[model samples]
Target: MGSNPAAPIEVHDLTVAYRKKPVLWDIDFELPEGRLIGLVGPNGAGKSTLIKAIMGLMPLLSGYVRVYGQPLEDRRELVGYVPQRESVDWDFPVDALDVVTMGRYGRMGLFTRPSKEDYEIAMACLDKVGMADYAKRQISQLSGGQQQRVFLARALTQDASIYLMDEPFAGVDAATEKAIIELLKELKSKQKTVLVVHHDLNTAEEYFDWLMLLNMRLVKFGETRDVFTQENLRMTYGGKLHLLSEAAEKVARQ
Candidate 1:
């Protein structure tokens, strides 16, 4: 809905499903440019599926997704994806820098070796995530938070304009979460767009500017404060949680 010159990621009448069971339906929304938008919902809510469909990782049952006014594949270098921690095997034999270099593979094309410039870019990404010191360490040695940061660094090395993250906070520690938030805010400041799949309701208000509530059926999506109210929360979370949160907020204010 924003009229900004920088085009945002737009999903129009988007629908996605698995085995003919509809997971998302008639989902229409515009993720404004330069904001940290959180996609919140319970398990099986299709939060991850939403990002996957946008990124072209999954087939769309219907509708269309556009990034910065162009389709996803057309701007491959402009889209970065940080999948769930469980998405990859931890025992893989790769160092932090080694992992970051993969981000440049798209620009370098397939089966080609990384040039010196690629290594420089990867190191810069490591520095961005505060993992420059751990560049030599194997990924398996990292804590959950550190591992997520490494993945973030990988995405950053790609210099993408749009970021789609699936539950980046799931297993990370509080400290790491804070660090990641700081990094994301920096990205927003640079006019890059970030959409995260999140679950912690307590911190949802503080973490995002826009909120998309999904229950495998496109419950809601809009400005965070507007859509995260008690009425919408009930529809998104449940009636009991709405009552509890309302009471808690009233008590805190009193």
Candidate 2:
């Protein structure tokens, strides 16, 4: 599950496949509703696949995903998604504000234009992410971190209770990562649930309250402090090591 029902996103027995090959298997967990949760794993471990399946971005082999106690698709407004920075073209013509306004497109309903209120909400979301000054700037001109912030602002504009972010910190500098972490903390303060697909091992404990460790299957899901241990880290990133360490990594990095 993504987060608590009282909190934000939830998933049960989530299984996903790519081209008939299973990528995720029987993942079940509850995020602490309004807190930040981190999804950590090796490459090809299906971290991004988990969020995508939950978001209906692709079909799920089995399992369920809910936002605010309802199926996500039925209650789309209660959810927001920030895809990877590499997921889209930076050269696209859309400006920062224009991206944020997409959040309201759903609320505006099909075949209609945005209203004045939509603009206000989009501006507010941009401001929330500290990008109001660059609302009109083309995305290509921004740095990696700024671009990430803009994407986050777009998600915020949706005003959803749950946020699913894929590799939010992938290409950003430390300063940008810190800034984004701070913004996530602020979202927690507002009782919004956030799930981030994170790869950096160094900042795991410091940045997230909950962790979903995966490798094409649910390895472990619980409090970051309890679940993040020497043995687990060994299992999670051991392949990078040698001998016994490498073997453990093999079992974990399914």
Candidate 3:
């Protein structure tokens, strides 16, 4: 589909490379506002790379990205990001509450301390992710799921209009997954846009209202029911889709 000026995220001809080897090629798509979007593909398909590109963390070899029809730098405050759990330095010497408090830095004046309200907001966000009890615990001391929950709390503290999350569900327990999906739905209800880099084919259809299939390039971008087809799966995954196809079929049947 053509770009939507009113879309939460509009990426056009985006290309990213490392050491002159392309990781993402000519990616172009506009994400609808206030919807749950899934970015799915095989390993090395550059799903995480795409998220970083939109967040302006990665240098683009070509094209551009816009948030709410404005340059990312102009609307940076409106976007929140949650990097993959694996990418975080969990061993950092900081408590869960301290980590969540950092999310407010974007809104705070430089060199200024967090106000009481900021701390209250951070605590509330931690509570929302079921980690208020562990707010004072060192991040390195928490379990994998707990660490992820703390990061989610950090993102919530931003209270941005759009959120770009990288595999928030990876390696989490079922309870954490349930909690995360519930929180994502709540964000949607509040008319906030969320984009997640996801790997679970089994739960993708159930989790996202929109899907963007990619394999270093755009395969399809549309409603989940329209884009999550066997043909598109084959095109996106090729020989890697045999088992994933069976799982997708099961989800469809359900």
Candidate 4:
């Protein structure tokens, strides 16, 4: 199939498996550019897995992902990723500014080190996320909300056209959540696409303009008001797929 230039993200026949068990199956969807999208699903519903596959971090069992009508590898510079906070080793002895500087590494190349201007850019991004004062503080010393802000700062430094974030609001305080929502709005205003893996059903409608509901498959994907209905929520969260749930549980245990 031909790629859609207008869509910032497109997944065709995407499937991911672990040890012969499928996590996401036959996933297909295209996200419009410049919108805040929420990937909402239950635990083990392959939210993180889908983002990983799109980023080319995980081996796809089958199918393809395209960003701006190009393969992910070809479009790496155009995409920024904010991984789950738990995925990182916070105690690794890196300060907040150092962590944000890592975002510029992609643009800096393998041999060149971050220059003084790069540090300025990183600090500017930290200030955007309201974490400039703690730039020199160790990442481990920051609270959960503070750590999340730092990660966002790093993504901002990438200056990408599309951003994929995993559970950004999880464990954050109300103020942090509000700040993130505002940042997302700013990105949208600038015509950037953002796909966030979100867990809270209560605020999903309020936070995102679009929604992609997944349950080991594509249940629905569209505008929030149209797809974020009672019936869709039941299909996503309600216990309708016992076998899939069992497989997901097994994979989680591994």
The TM-score leader among the candidates is 3
- Expressed as tens digits, the lDDT of each residue in 1-254 for candidate 2 is 33446435667898888898999988877667677889998788899988888889978889898765788778888888999889899999989888888888988757789888888999998887778899999999999999998888888888888889999987787677777888898889998888899876667788999988888777788889998887776576544556435544554454
Which of the two candidates, 1 or 3, achieves a greater TM-score against the reference?
Answer: 3
Tens digit of per-residue lDDT, candidate 4, span 141-207: 9999999999999999999999999999988987788889889999999999999999777678889
Q: What is the lDDT of candidate 2?
A: 0.82
Clashing pairs in 3: none
**TM-score result, candidate 3:** 0.94
Q: Candidate 1, after superposition: displacement of residue 77 in Å?
A: 1.2
Candidate 1 lDDT tens digits, 116-171: 99999999989888899999899999898899998999899889888989989887
TM agreement with the true structure for every prediction: 0.91, 0.88, 0.94, 0.92
| Candidates ranked by TM-score | 3, 4, 1, 2
Worst 10 residues of 2 by lDDT: 243-252
lDDT of 3 by residue, 90-198 (tens): 8889999999999999999888999999999999999998899999999999988888899899999999999999999888987889889989999999999999999
Error of 1 at 209 (Å): 1.1
Name the regions of candidate 1 deviating beyond 4 angstroms.
2-6, 238-254
Q: What is the C-alpha lDDT of each candidate?
A: 0.85, 0.82, 0.91, 0.90
Q: Point out where model 3 deviates above 4 Å.
A: 239-254
Error of 1 at 246 (Å): 14
